[model samples]
Target: MVHTQEYESLLPTKNTKHSHRRRSFIIIILVTIAILLGTTLGLAYGFIYWKSRCIKTHKHVQLKHVLPGSFGIEFKLHTKNTSDTSTENDITIKWEHEPKDIRYRQKTEEMVSNDSVLTTVTIVNNNATVSYELGNETCWLNPDNSSIFEWYSILPLIMESVRSNHREDGCRERMWTTTYNGRRVFICIIDQRISYIRYDNRVAQSQEWMVPSQSSIKLPSDATKCGMMDSEMTSLLVVDDDKRQNTSDSTRQQLSYSQTYRKDNEYLKQPEIFVRSAKPDCLFIHGIGVKSPKTGYKSLKSMSYWGHIEKNTPQCSSHKFIQFNTVDNGWDSVSLHKMFCEFATGSNVDGRISNKIIFTHSMGNNIVAAALHRKVCSFDVQSSKWFSVSAPWRGSKVVLKLEDLCSGHLGPSHHKSENLLWLVLEHTKYCTHEGKMSPAYRTLHPTYKSPTGISYDDLVAVARLHVTGALCGTSPWGMGLSLSFSGTLKFIQSFSHLDQPNDGVVALNSCNVFGKKFQSIAKFALMSVNHLESSMKFGCRKPLCSWYQIL
Candidate 1:
């Protein structure tokens, strides 16, 4: 009996051990699951937060601040809806007066699509409240839903017209127009920049314009003064007209293929081997990505067309190439405008104002267009011709991709082990994004329709010619990424949204604008030449010298 009792006790102890083991195993699995779930949720939250921050940062607007004083301001609102259905009543305007101490008078007039709804508002008291608003589903102002209360002392324009019978003496008035969302808007200023804005002749909602002035009020004449300052004391090198004509006549005949240089000429001492003309008639403007001397590349001299132009176009052999500091400072449209203004107004080598034939590549086209839009170039009587090659009239979508990649929104899947590699990739992408968002890109973006007064037809009036290359083959390396199995896969994945043929850099569809009103002189299907090669002849080991034949 004693032996049986002892054995039974041992059996119970063994059973207890088995139960303990099973419970431990269950606890470990639950803990592991909880850890995994926490990690996933954390990553998801981080991604969402980052995305929201990006959107908010991009949406925020920067407004200018103007002082509070007795001023006359006019509001001109224009709206357009491309939908078949009209959005006439969908638009609304609101205004506010601050401190409730100022008397306001307003007048509103409605006009056609191209016309503006003129509103003249007058402020009677100093330190008055002024604010303006526009409401519509689709249309807004240049800065978008922004009120000028901060920038100008005017509440909104509420007067009938400065030319009306109730005009005040010494009330200076000026008008400026801007186009936004298919709408043309005009703002007029009178004695004091104070105007009341209302929707459909309704009373404007008033708010106190109490913000402290950051700067003095800017008058219309200030703009004219600035323009004059830009043109003041400028130097120009002019080519003699008689010499220019002789150069043109002498080189009118095309050079035979045999006359072209295929290999390095031992007898040639300088990089420029072409024959020189007595005078230059054409101006050569290089495209974006043109490196400066600081970058170890001679801006214009490095270009494949540099040599070709000298060799082929006798009119350009002796011309001074316009070497813009594009690589270092970026191709800023405003700067280009000033440069063109100087060029157009400044005298040539012979101290005479002369018409020019412009040849541009890539983003150089944007500079040409901007100069024309700003009227910097006198298009009257003078026959100004423009030749654009690989013009990204609609901008490149690759910029958006590069921006995303730099922002870490797109990249190789992240792993703890590859964190260092990921950082390097991110840095490279950021540099590329910063390097490429030139002013030219901003102007070329699809959303940035040409300047208010400019059109393709207007450009064509200057006799524009466009050349684009298509049928580009797959690049071994694209935008600094290898095209191995994994790299190519990533390349495709990154640019999967692009559907048209690209010259390694720019899509064929985005290369030129085509319409009933717009057409290219010729389209070449160069299977091997990519975007850079289209304008950059020496881009490849065996340079595509043949491509320059079109010039």
Candidate 2:
């Protein structure tokens, strides 16, 4: 190794003329070699420093406890190198990483390889190649890019349409805010040259590497946001996150969630959601099946939807389940809205809007979605926390499936399936309009971009805006209990594996309020339970004490 010496030679000044002459030829050669060496070393060091600051990333790192999934949905945030064509960063998401239910019927036809590719994208500038596994059949999200890998969803479009709305107006159309362990620590919609905070990992200013996860995380996949022809599905997460940040802006203030103290003496330990100082004023909205109940939740306790909750907390209790005058009839959005508004608007502090927590199950969520969107909103959306149980955000293609299955689509072989057919048929009949879907059902049906402007996504947004906070939670009975409604669901999922994971009643994604807006929303901890199980506690037949956990 040739080390450059900075010290001065003391004897050099006194060196003889003859000695200096002889050494001059050798000195000239050494000087020439040293110059070439120094130049080579300087260029190599500069390249290393630039790459470290711009493209450095750490993999599989731990993150702070936030939600419950404790895992992250990975997103590539590096600037594409147009000059380099390296395949070192190519990633293939495996189908097997997701565990399949044992009770799931084997679809022998759509045999998925353990290594089957899921993400669809086109690569031009040697950007990392990422693949995903979103069930059977190749998903076509952005017909132009060919896959999920190439195209970004709604936020990018909203950013494009309304560039003046954002603070980062200087950013380009493809700009992405640097996301961290499910949090946006720093948002620079410019390039990799900006600094970011990826949770515990401290990085140089230029790295755009992603952080890890905790809970409440979501990804941009067409499976969850599938066939989004409707404005609702396309814009489920389009609400600006900044509005949630402003404190003084008074039209609609967002709720901030913090851990709370639960009362042990309470009769029921309801699933935790939202951030609140005191117990909420509880309102239980039952499902379509319970619309014609013989009596209210008091009579059908623990049996009907919303029946899991107690009538009243022991004096000075946490919440009160609001009782409304009921008549036996199928659900109609207009009537339900007026009735709900009257009961909810009763003279409480601030008229009708203070410390309210609304709980809806199955079809009940459909109505709540409508009520939140209506112009004459009576129910308090600002000071309330909304819980949606088993809501179908995207419309389910259940026309033939519901009718055919009741008519022996399973061939009467399974006696267990035969018994529940009548019950299923009776419940489904109420949702049909024009021999198919009622107006509310149409909102939940797969209309995909109709001109009528009925959108479940807009429903999601309205709740986010008006309510202090909201969450959509339920157990997807992917594999149902043998002699129950889940058995019917298991049968449907058996044949329709490509529909993606669902709770037999609603697809998992439909009930989940996650994505850019919700900020990597975590998976429900109650994954072990099914749709019907929501009425009862997790792992017991008693009243529901637990449903949606942080996990």
Candidate 3:
């Protein structure tokens, strides 16, 4: 109905293609604006959400940072006040940078589990400190042998962040911004002396990052300037920060647990070197009661002595004899197992395999047996002949006597005796009336019943023989040689007379493993020899050496 300007007609031809192109361009512009607006709004909403949640109080809690190592990877702990309204039993503090769906996460899953807030959580005291260490999950090592790596070359970036915050005087200062538990607690250096950061962060959020403001500062401004040696000296002064009281059953239960294995460089000395490349003729294991250093020394000496012996053997004319330490008698059973695992399997220490030999021994033979039952490492017991010399297949009477002398301070024999007595009383009080004893205790004959089917009868028999021999001074190396042999004969006779098949000292019926299994599973034979039967007489050897015959 209105008059159009002449320029409108001249501007473009009114073709359908031109109209369609114009409409498409407009739609694209609208979509682009919508996307930009949505992105901006979402970012704003997220920032607000994070700020709102950042300062919220965890119920009945005060905050503290007890993290070890650098200030950057600060470890935090909080104390929580318990109330009837709270359902959780334990409180744990952990670090997380992103949601679980993130592609890379290096911390232990238990440290970050969402369900950590369950009813099993233990209540922490007002001054408890939480601790954690950061390690590289990506580092690889060859299990067969030691890998060469510079010990200090691999510090993490998180440690670097904390290093920047270290105070003078070698103390690490940790400060707090929020009331995490109930108190506004902070973590300072455990020891200002040896304060090289122990905790490290493996992941990086970005190529360039700013330090977080919330982390506490490390104290003693001079702490960061010391050399590596000085750092260790400073660290010696710092005590452990974990002070969670024994409030929960689980925490209390951990009292009996072993500490994690930490290697002591001073303890690692060169092992006894056997220069020979050939297989050893025989390996000997001596009994317990060794001087600590002598245990290592004798282990090495065994190789040296065996090498000399092998040179004289008929089998080797030119080949050298080599020996390796198997089970050293000095270590306790626990220490023995741990050492074997580290050296044999390279579970912790970078160890190598170098020795294989026919086995022989005294008390240590039994330890070898115990190690086999435990299957502690990659040790192979089935490949060699095991010749046991004066083996204690049963509980040792000597072990009990030595223990009684010490009033139960040392040795396996004492522990076993105590356990036996405890089991006996428990069975008498709880089981005899109902005839419903736990199979384990009943099988052990805990109540010390009559001689028939009574398990302790074997223990008693061994003890009695031990006491008899003690009066005569007649053990294997005792002063009375003839009486000792007679006692040995008596011990053997008792075993044969038992209605139950026994190991002459321990019972064979129970199938309880002996201490000789380190060599027992191998092909072995026993023989007696004495030093006097040397030098050929008309190319004929003595028919019987009296000392050897007595043996």
TM-score of each: 0.35, 0.40, 0.24
Worst 10 contiguous positions by lDDT, candidate 3: 141-150
What does the lDDT read for residue 410 in candidate 2?
24
The CA lDDT of each predicted structure is 0.36, 0.36, 0.26
lDDT of 2 at 131: 21
Q: What stretches of model 3 exceed 4 Å from their correct place?
A: 1-278, 294-298, 303-332, 340-355, 358-360, 372-375, 380-387, 397-551
Give candidate 1's total backbone clashes. Answer: 37
TM-score of 2: 0.40
How well is each residue in 268-368 modelled by candidate 2, as lDDT tens digits? 33333455576555666655543332433232223323332453222122434433323243233465655555545552222354566666666666565
CA shift of 424, model 3, Å: 33
lDDT of 1 by residue, 257-300 (tens): 11122221211222222233334256667666444443222223
Model 2 local distance difference test score: 0.36
Per-candidate clash tally: 37, 23, 42
In the order shown, what is each candidate's alpha-carbon RMSD?
29.4, 21.6, 27.7
